[model samples]
Target: MRTDDSGALDLSDGDPILAVETLLLTRDGRPGGWRRAIHRADDFKYVFASNR
Candidate 1:
């Protein structure tokens, strides 16, 4: 998944919605991976990977 801005939200899944939602709330959010960016603070990369 990808977003146009830092505050944008993106989602990806290879499983059921219920399972995805559970992972989103439990794993991704807790580890700051769900709504977080991967590049450096100054980098303008647009790619976002969230299993949740």
Candidate 2:
């Protein structure tokens, strides 16, 4: 999860990683089916997870 000014996105703080643990998330322990993985903003549709 590393990027620079040449990043594909139009935004960057010279940082490589935006959010960590991009593979899993858990707001509670009931929705075992509400966790997912992807690189983007919070969709709240499937719960985008992160980790780095």
Please give, for residues 1-52, the per-residue lDDT of candidate 1 as tens digits: 2344323323333221211222245454564335433332333434779999
Candidate 1: which stretches are off by over 4 Å? 1-43
Candidate 1 TM-score to native: 0.14
Alpha-carbon deviation at 46 in model 1, angstroms: 2.2
Q: Report lDDT (CA) for all predictions.
A: 0.35, 0.42
Q: Report lDDT (Cα) of residue 19, candidate 1.
A: 15
How close is each model in CA RMSD to the real structure?
13.1, 10.5
Model 2 misplacement above 4 A: 4-6, 14-38, 42-44, 47-52
TM-scores, one per candidate: 0.14, 0.22
Q: After superposition, how far is residue 26 of candidate 1 from its true place, in Å?
A: 20
RMSD of 2: 10.5
